[model samples]
Target: MFYSFIFILFFFNQVKTKSIVSINREANKIIKYVNNIPNNTWKAGFNFKSKQLKEIENIMGVLPINEKYTQSLEDLGFAIHHNSNNILDKDFNEIEVLPENFDASKQWSKCKSILSVKNQSNCGSCWALSTASVFSDRICIATNGSIDNNLSGEYLLSCCTGSCGRGCNGGHPEKAWKFIINNGICTGGDYGSNEGCQPYSIAPSAVELSFENTADTPECYHTCTNPHYTTPLQNDLYFASKVYTVKPKMKPIMYEIYKNGPVVAAMKTYEDFFHYKSGIYQYKTGSSKGDHAIKLIGWGEENGMLYWLAVNTWGTLWGMDGIFKIKRGSNECGIESRISGGLPKL
Candidate 1:
C-alpha cells in the first residue's frame, strides 16, 4: 500500500511540472517575439497573461468568415441600382488630389458617432459591431451630421437570421449590411449606457490582464430595452439606400473614404496583433489567429511608413484607446482585400 501511494504522488508531481513548463514556454515566446522585432515599427504588450494558449484564443472577437458562403452586393445586382454606371464614377471628380492624411471624424466634426470606440465585451461579435458602427457613421454623414445616432450592434448580433452568420460566433460583414438595407437596425449604445434603445447585453472582459470568458448570443428582441426610450421599434430603425464594395486597391480605398466616409474592413489578424500598443503594425512573429473586423477612419504616415488608422472593438483598454494602425497599401494581413460601405436613406 505504501509503495502504491508513493508511485501515485510521483506521477502527479511529474504532470504538474510539465504543466508549469508549458505555461512558461508560452509566456516566454510572447516576450521573446516582442524583443526581437526590428526597426521599432510598432509596439506590443499583453492584455491577458494567460497560463494556456486556449485562453488567449478566446479573447479575440472575430471568426473565420468564409467568402464562399457570403454573397457580395454585386452578386445581388446593386450595380444597376446605382444606374448601371460604375459606383466609383460618381465620386472621383473631387478625389484627384488625395490628401496625405484624412480623418472622417475631423472631416465631419459634428458626426459624434463616427468617433465612438465600442467594446464587444466577451462576445465574438466583431463582425456585427464593426458593420453596425460604420452604418451609424454613414447615417450621420449622410444627414449632414443632423442625425448622430448609434445603431444597435446587439440588434444585428441577434436578429440577422440568415446569411449574416452566427451571432457572437462571428458573422459576415456583407450580410450584416444587407440586413441593414432590408430590415434597418434600431438605435443602441454600449453596455449599460442606456443612450440608445438596446444597449449591449454582454459586459466587457472585466480587467485588462485576465482571460476572456465566452458569452452566448443575446436573445433577439424588437422592443427597446430601456423603458424610458419611447420610440417604437419601427420608428427607431435606420435604413440604407445602397451598399457597395470597394476595389481592393490603395488608391480606390483612399478615394472612397475621401468622397464618402469611413469604411469597415476585415483583416487577417495574427496572435501578435493582440499585443499591439502603438505605432504602425506589420505582422511580425506569430501564427494566424483568425480574421478580425475593424473601422478604418483615416490614413497617415509615421516614420515614412504609411498606415491606415483603424478602430478595434476590444474596448479602450486594448490597443491605443481601442485604435491601431496596420501597414497600408501593401494589403497587410489582407486588410485591403475586403472593404464595404453604403449610403444611408435619409
Candidate 2:
C-alpha cells in the first residue's frame, strides 16, 4: 500500500512540474512579445492574469479580427433603403468653430447618459455595439437627458438584416443607423438583463480565452419574444432621421461630437492593437488584418500627444477599462475616414 501511494504521488508531481514549466515558458513568450513590438508607446501586460498564460495567448490569437469589409459592402450586408440621389445632400453641412478641448463623459455628468464601457465578447458585433452606443447617447443628449436608456446592440446585429450585415460575420455602422431611423430599437441592457426586447445573448464573464471558439452568431428575431421581456412602448423606442458622415477632418469630426453626442468610427486595426493597455495608440507594426468599429466619444491631448477617446465593445476588462486612446488628427488607422452619426429624433 505504501509503494502504491508513493507511485501515485510521484506521477502527480511530474505532471505538476511539467505544467509549471509550460506556464513559465508561455509567460516568457508573452514578455518577449511585449518587448518586441516596435515603437509601441502603450504598455502590454496580462490583463487576465488569473488565466493560464497559454490560455491568454490563445485568447489573443482567436479574438475575431474584424474582417467583414473584405467583400463589397452589399455582399457584407449593407443594403441601402433610402434614395441615393439625395443621400449626400443631408444636413451634415453644418459648420462650427473648433473647440480647444471637449470631453462628453465630463460635460454630461448629471445625465450620466454616457454609457459605461461594454464588451462585445468573441463576436464581431463591434459594428452593432458602436452604433447602438452612439444612438443611446445621442437620444439622451437630444432629449435633454430624459431619454437616457441603453439601446440594444443585439437587436441591430440580428434584426437589421439587409444592410447591417450578419451577427458574428460583420456589419456596417451606416446601415445600422438606417435601421434605427426606420425600424427603431428597444432598450436592452447587457447580457443578463430582461429590460428590453432582446438582451445580448452572450455573457462577457462566461467567455473562454482558449483555442476552442464556441460562441456563434444568433439568428435574427424580429419580434420581442423573450418570455421575461416585453416590447418597449412606441414613445420609448428611439429612432433617428438625419444620418450623415462627418468629413474626415479634425475640426469637422470634433464639431459633430461636440454638437451631437458620440459618433461611430471605422478604424484599421493591426495585431499590435490586441495588446493595447494605455498610452496614445498609433499603428506601430503588424499587418493590417481587419477593421474595427468603435464609438468616438471625445478627444484630448495627453503629454503633448493628441488622442481620440474611443469606447470599445470588448467589455471593461479588455482595453483601458474598455476605453482606448487612438492618435488623433493625423488620421492614424483611417479613424477619421468613416466617422458617421445622426441626430436622434426627440
Candidate 3:
C-alpha cells in the first residue's frame, strides 16, 4: 500500500513540458479553441498572461468590436496591426479578366469554375501573382471589357529585370509593369512550380507589357493567343490612381485571374504571421522583410474608416477565407505611404 501510494503521488506530481492549443475559426469571427495540456496544467492556451491580456485589452480599449476573431496577427511575426469588419458587395460588373483570345480560358472553360483564393494553395508568391493579376485587370478593362490577359507569375519569377524581384520576398508591382512592358508577358505554364521557367516568347506587339528572357518565349497564360482575338494593347500600372469605387480594385496583370484574390502589399516582415484579432491597427515589432506579399481584391468603410479587402497566400483557413480588410491609403501598408504609390511610365 505504501509503495502504490508513493507511485501515485509521483505520477500526479510529474511536470508538464508542453501543451498544444488548436484554434478553429469560422467566418472571420467564430473561433473555437481547445487546449490540450497536461491534465492539471492550464498550459496550452494564450501566450500572453492574464495580466498581459488585461494590459493589451486596456491598450486596445478603444478598438472596434471584433469578437468574431480570436487570433491577433500582431505581426507576420514582424509588423502589422489589428482586426477586421467589412461587407461583400456584388455590385460590380460580371466580366472575368484575362489576356486576349480564347485559347486557355476556352480550353479550361468547363473545368475551371472561377477559382477563388480559398481554393488556391499558393505560398509566398502573392506579390508576383497579384502584380500579374492587376496588370491583366487593367488591360482587360482598358480593352473594352476583354477578359483574356493572364500572364504567368512563373515567367516573372525567372526573367524579370533587376535582382531577385521574384523570390519569396514581395516583387515590385509598379516595377513589374515596366518589366512586362519591356519584355512582354508569358503564359503561367511557360514557367513551372516555384522553380524552372521555360518561356516560349511570341512576336513583340506594339503594346507589349514585359518580356521573357532571350532563351524563353512569351506564351499566353490561359493559352488563348489567336491573332484575331488577341488585343495589341498591354496592361500597365498607374501611380496615384484614384480609388474609383468604394474599393480600389487590384488590377490583374499576371498568371492568376480571380475577381477576388490577393494583391501585393508591403507588410513589415518575412516570418510566421500571427492572426490579427483587433478591428483597427497601426503597426508592430519586427523587420520590414519586404519578403511577404498579399492580395487586395475588395474594400469599403466601416464607421467612416477606410479599408481595403485583401488575400494572403497562407491558406483559406486564415483571415476571412484567407482574406482581410486593411486600412486603405494608410501608412501601415507601405504602398500609400511609400512614394504616394507613384508608378512611372514603362
Best by lDDT: 1
Question: Model 3, residue 140: displacement in angstroms?
Answer: 2.3
| Model 2 Cα lDDT, one tens digit per residue, 1-346 | 9999999999999986787677565545654676677765566655443233333322221122244542343353433222212323243355444555678877675445475676676667778888888888888887778877788888887787556666666767777777887888877768876756677887784433532353576777666645676544454467776676666777667767887778888887765576678778887655555778888989988778888988877777767888888889899998887877877776
Task: Spell out the clash pairs found in candidate 2.
Answer: 77-163, 78-163, 79-163, 118-315, 119-313, 119-314, 119-315, 120-313
lDDT of 2 at 40: 55
Worst 10 residues of 1 by lDDT: 78-87
Query: How accurate locally, in lDDT, is each candidate?
Result: 0.78, 0.69, 0.33
Model 3 Cα displacement at 16 (Å)? 16
Residue 329 displacement in candidate 1 (angstroms)? 0.6
Q: What TM-score against the true fold does each predicted structure earn?
A: 0.86, 0.75, 0.42
Q: Predict model 3's lDDT versus the native.
A: 0.33
Which has the better TM-score: candidate 1, or candidate 3? 1
Please list the residue runs of candidate 3 whose C-alpha ends up more than 4 Å from where it truly belongs after superposition.
1-124, 161-166, 189-264, 269-273, 277-291, 338-346
lDDT of 1 by residue, 1-346 (tens): 9999999999999986787677657656865677576776887776544442445555355555454443354576443222112546546554467889888889999988887998876677888889899989888887898899888999999998556777877777877888888899999988888878887888776654334456788999989887768898889999888776777788778777777788878888777787788889888877787778899999988889999989999889788888888899899999998788878888
Off by over 4 Å in 1: 1-25, 51-53, 56-75, 78-95, 208-213
The TM-score ranking, best first, is 1, 2, 3
lDDT per residue (tens digit) for residues 227-273 in model 3: 33333323321221221111223322111223222234545431112
List the lowest-lDDT window of 10 residues for candidate 3.
Answer: 55-64
